[model samples]
Target: MAIGVAAGVSVGTVISPYAGAALADDAAGPSYLLVGGTGSSNIGVLRESGGRLIPVGQPVPTDTGTLSITVTPNGRFAYVAHTVSGTLQGFRVGDDGTLERLEGAHLAPGRPIVGAVVSPDGKWLFATVGSVTNDVQTYAIAPSGALTHVDSVTIPGATSGLSIPVVSPDGRFLFAPSFIGATMDSYAIGFDGRLTPTGSQVPTGDRPALPSVTPNGKFLYITNEGTDDVSGYRIAPDGALNPIGRFPTKAIPHGMAITPDGRYLYLPQTGGQSVNGFEIRDDGALVPVPGAEAPSAPGHLPGRVVLSPDAQRLYVIDTLTTTGTAKVFTYRVKPNGGLEATAELPVDTGVTFSDGATGVFASLGPA
Candidate 1:
């Protein structure tokens, strides 16, 4: 009975942090999934083992169509964003990594809350709202896992609306890119988890949709849908940006993920129906891996890429355009930066996938 789950919540096996760590130490714990999309329901839940994902139960309902989801650092909670209604939902992460919606967890940060990201310390959650309003809401996380609204910052220059707010791995800076402006706005996270605009925004390629920072906090990469390339930046010590270079990629690339080792970058090209792999050089140059592209069915456009904590395995979710249907694929990371799709056929996820990732799976007891 984790806090805020309300009475008679049937989600089974919520484990303690210590027990979860023990399961993770043994490498037997299964990973969990929280996907957001335009479906009959707003969100979906699933579990993963041996590089395959299957629904854990029925899809979890949300206030509207869903956008993206981010888990807290301790693997204890998850926060999901809605595509409409300007609301965000919170959940308790079961010990088995199952999600139990928390009562009174519906929060209206602003109208049309579109993007959400959890601080690496698990102490804060940030969300962007109202492209017209340019509002970014901040919430403090209590020990009981409740969210207390903190402060809101407005970006007057974000006329096109804000993309996702990506926190630096070391938790020092937050980057918010505007899709229409070709700009990446930055903020310095204060000691109290408040955000102050650092004003280090650099111009990206064009129509930058998704931006991801390296796990080492050294560089940032953004997908340019309009430019058909990926933009790279060298992160300054104080969280400023120095233009590294722009690397050509597949068309309409939407998702950007880096391996845990910080040595490789993976971009799922929406137009090509394949994933392009790159070896991350120290100078932030993306050198293509020989035969790094893994082609899939044409309609199955890849959305998200999640890496195993050890960086040995990668999971990709592919979804069709019109229907609420998707397929999840697993790939083995070869030592040479090549992605070898596991022999397993794509599993019919049976739901549109808008949001998901890989982190701490679950902490099971003495499995």
Candidate 2:
């Protein structure tokens, strides 16, 4: 049965089939995935339609060891990073938004993996490995969505790290926020897809986590879990980051994302259990937009925030509770950077999953 989008209601399902792709060709209104805690170490896919989030398919298990997952720009495949297992799992997307495990279930590089992301061109995949081994491994995407390790680069002081690696929109630079070091490092992506340290590390507030780039590729934002602030950096031509502003957040900011229109930013403060919205000024500074805070319901721990392809809706994922149930919230995006509740629904994963279920969903839309 097909899930219908109702006003201000969350809906979900667990099945594998190709639902029709009926989004407009506006370059901004594609469906999204809300990857978070699953019953058994897996990720969930939620399709956004008319400001509501409906479960389009079943949760795809990443085996034991995968922690963070990210989809390519085209949304054709997803890369799952297994922090404990030191492997990355690749999954191909079926027409109905369900995931099918690719030929290679595990790409083991013998390093503790923290995050994985596909390059803007979707030709390569990058994984950040830390703890036991502090390095970034590069892999070429095979035609069948499998990964073949190409090269690896060791960061000087990345021995203690947690944040995932992020590539710039231009695909010329890479940013990795190290929680242990409390800094964000930059690297230059060479022509051959190799990474070269840019020798520039920007000091962040404290325990910096995810680092996201702006839509225009002019600014980078980093969320500091320890200091309760978001740091902004201006993107320099030579792949260097210059500080723009460091603004205070409500509490512990975890996940963050810039809107598709490049006008607003959304960050989920886990400590306060609220989502903070900001207006992006031309100078790269962020000002909290009025009426932009969305509080998480009781007993829900919000994990990440992402925007729909059309920039008209936002999705927030909440990891499951003690009883083993997940949730995804949908919001209508206002022109002035405020959010209105559309739907808040619970997702049922057939099994119980743990902390390794942290990941963000993506759609096949514009860069």
Candidate 3:
């Protein structure tokens, strides 16, 4: 049977045979895992062939209930943060793009693990512990891709707050967004991977959800889920957040991503069930991308937005349904940072075979 889903100006087809065969490619690419509140914890391997997303292997079972995931820069390791268990799990990527469980399955620090990221050097891992404790934990990543506990420091106002941590591209700073405190806190990273607060917290909008640093390492963007806006900040040399501007967006701007060239920022509005694009000016102001808002189907809670490594395609994950379904939206990014939709591919996470919460595209790296 063939399934037809809306892609922007036209309809895209998903044939069962093609999907099944695509799932058998040898170079099906690295496995992308998705974790959430449901019990659907599995890894998806995708191959970008013929300008299409081809699934190569079957999903592997990861027992840890992951709320978020981050893959290492080398794509050899994937770390998942479990919200309920308050731990992190490490998995090694095999040749076939399958995941092999490492020794560190559930390393908990007495708090819920909301976000985790590998350092730019791939030497250390940091995770945000979203507990009343309000601490960011550090771990030394072994050569075998295992994590060893290193140290942790508490954010002064992070207690009972949702601190989302992100490491800068230069490997010099780590920024954590505190929802309850309404602040974006900065920390200077020591050579040994220890974090020391930089004594600066730039206040942000209500309920800041996720923080993203531009690829150029010059600016930071945070999504305010409660306010339906995105706040931009200029990165100071001393690891300080200098407010650039706050731009209004659709309702519930949950997930966001900056293009590879650092010219465009994509926001996925969960409540509005739409995707909005913005052009980044040289002065750190965001101008809404013309003709970029695409309506989504009902119950399509867009969770995360990511661009292809080549910067040719845009992908959004829908999180409302239990069956994993990713709305793969392709776009032709113009020279001026505007976006035009090319096609949309609806991928089944092997849940319904027709439509269901299959899995989310957690992170996208090169093939």
Which segments of candidate 1 are over 4 A away from where they belong? Answer: 1-29, 158-160, 321-324, 353-367
RMSD of 2: 7.3
Tens-digit per-residue lDDT, 327-362, candidate 3: 444566566655666665566443211111122343
RMSD of 3: 8.5
| lDDT per residue as tens, model 2, 130-162 | 673367878888767877778988766634466
What local distance difference test score does each model get? Answer: 0.70, 0.71, 0.67
Candidate number that wins on TM-score, 2 or 3 = 2
In terms of lDDT, model 2 sits at 0.71
**For each predicted model, how many residue pairs clash, with residues at least 3 apart or on different chains?**
4, 9, 11
Q: Write the per-residue lDDT of candidate 1 for residues 1-367, one digit (tens) a residue.
A: 0111112223333332333332453365445655666443344555655455656555555565455577777667777766555567788776555566766556764466667888888889888777543567788988766788889888657364746678999989988887767888788898888889875668898888878999889999988889999999998888888898999987777776788888888878877788889999999999999866888665677877767655677767774544347767778889888988788776655566454221123322231
Candidate 2 vs candidate 3: which has greater lDDT? 2
Error of 3 at 44 (Å): 3.7
Residue 356 in candidate 2 has what lDDT?
34
TM-scores of all candidate predictions against the true structure: 0.87, 0.86, 0.83
